[model samples]
Target: MKKILMGVLCLSTLLCGCTKNKDIQIDDKKVGQVKLKFDHIVGAKKLVLNDGTYSNNSNETFNINILKYFVSNIKFTKTNGEVFTIPKEESFFLINASQSESLQPTLNIPEGEYQTLEFNLGVDSLTNTLPVEKRAGVLDVATNGMYWDWNSGYIHFKIEGTSAASPNASKSYKYHIGFFGGYETRTVNNNRVIKIDLTKAGISKVQENLSSDIHLMVDIGKVFDGPNSMSIATTPMVMHSGPHSDIADNYATMFTHDHTHNFQKIANNEK
Candidate 1:
């Protein structure tokens, strides 16, 4: 009778421990949302569409009239080294400096402490070739001006402005960079993947009932001068067919993580 009672007690202790462990286990399947807030800036100054004049490293002052680009293929890395990628269909976003609504791209992802954020600076090649009907929302050609003909694909990045250094009679310059390795014929692929480490700036704590805002600064001046600095006076126009790899390389260095803000999702919804 003593041995039997001892065996029963052990079984009851093990059952209680199992129940306690299950109560404290984290649900990895829980999901949260994050908003990527992009602030357009000219070096140290905030960007003003048509009036603000900024100077690049090449010593050319210019006033921007238009600034737009595509950001897609967003992914987040957790503290445990797990990667959660947003669905491809909902990942494409067109960020236009002129539009306030397009500045922040919200993404729903698994709940965790994310240590890194990754995204493509331009639309991927596969999505670029999708049928016209399949491409909707920001990718819709009829609604957005970023699209070129079916043969040339979409224009990933476009900027237009006026500068005294420009040699044009009107002193205007335009840079439209895009070419996704071509559909049939091979071309220069300017699509670049940008990764931002969140540990130094601020790690994103994405949890249930909370929204994390990852603030990023995009310096427009970097477009003119990064790894390859170019003078506006020498080459004012960079279209689909030209040496634009330098421009692409320069713009790739434009994004920097500024900070992160965690807000109560319920409170935001209430307001």
Candidate 2:
């Protein structure tokens, strides 16, 4: 009888242990939130629209009056090789430099350590061609001037400012870049897929109760000087009709992973 009681007690302990382990696994599977924070800068200086003056690689001094871009199709790769893609409806975001609320885009993902972050610098081809009803919110053409009528699609990236080096009479330069392989005919596609390895800077650790923020530095100076450099004096106006491949290649290298804040408590509003 003593031996039998002892065996029963052992079995009970094993079951309890298994239940605890299962609870832990369930907790690990819980969904967490992450925020992508974009810090726009010119070289090392913070970007201040309308007032702050900055110089590019071409030695042209300019003051940005407007800066806007789209970020979509965000995907996070876990350290264990699992990739989590945000739902299509929740992935599109417009980052306007003048708007404080548009700086950080949030995502809900399973709790894990993300080692890589990938996203499209512009609106995807399918999303851009979606019907007017489907393209609401930030993608709404009426809300923002980021969209063209019908033939041009969406403007992926736009920067407008006044530069003394510009040859224009207004001393202004505008670069409105957009082309998603064209709707009817093939055109210069400026949509770029940017992939950043987060291991070196710091991987995002998302937890159920905690929110992770991946801080990235966007150097606008690279727009003028990257793989293919351009001068404000020469190419002051880069509209949809001009060659944008060089500018696209240059802006692709603008983002760099700065660090990750993995221990931020989820705000009451965010929850």
- For candidate 2, report its TM-score: 0.89
lDDT string, candidate 2, 1-271, tens digits: 9999999999999999776121112245698889999999998899999999999888889989999999999999988898989998999999999998899988889888889999999988898778888788999977789988866489999999999999999999999999888777888788999999999988888878777899999999999978888899989999766658788888999999999887688889888
- Give one digit per residue, the lDDT tens place, for model 1 in 1-271: 9999999999999999776221122356886779899999998999999999999878889999999999999999988999988999889999999999899888877777889999998888998888878988899887778878755588889999999999999999999998889888898888988999999988888766668899999998988878887789888999876668888988899999999886545446422
lDDT of each: 0.86, 0.88
Q: Which 10-residue window of candidate 1 scores lowest in summed lDDT?
A: 19-28
RMSD of each: 10.9, 9.7
Instruction: Please give the lDDT score for candidate 1.
Output: 0.86
**lDDT of candidate 1 at residue 106, scale 0 to 100:** 80
lDDT of 1 at 190: 88
TM-score for predicted model 1 compared with the true structure = 0.87
